[model samples]
Target: MRAEAQAYADKINAALALLRRFIDWDKALRRLDELNARVEDPTLWDKPREAQE
Candidate 1:
């Protein structure tokens, strides 16, 4: 029984670790804001290469 419990805990910990790696909400939000700001800029289209990027 204890071994089963330990295995369950290990699975939970592994899932938590994967979640931590996959989700960076703050950084994602900041990057989204930056893209929004860039899109709002009129000068964004002046550089064709940069605009394509």
Candidate 2:
């Protein structure tokens, strides 16, 4: 039935949306980790301009 197909499509769209959100969250976390590592470096303070970024 068309209705059944529409329901499936809706579910697929929702799953894809959630997947995109999860991917975005994962990327943000990775970026934060990279920044944290940079902060932990003693030389980071040496480059104050770059560290401010």
Top TM-score: which candidate number? 1
Q: Write the per-residue lDDT of candidate 1 for residues 1-53, one digit (tens) a residue.
A: 99999999999999988887999967988989999999999999899899877
After superposition, the stretches of candidate 1 with alpha carbons farther than 4 Å from their true spots are 1-21
Listed in order, each prediction's TM-score against the native is 0.53, 0.52
Per-residue lDDT value at 43 in model 1: 99
User: How much is the lDDT of residue 19 in candidate 1?
Assistant: 83
Q: What Cα-based lDDT does every candidate model obtain? A: 0.91, 0.90
Q: Judge candidate 2 at residue 3 and give its lDDT.
A: 100
* Candidate 1: pairs in clash: none
Superposed by TM-score, candidate 1 places the C-alpha of residue 40 at a distance from the truth, in angstroms, of 0.4
Best by lDDT: 1
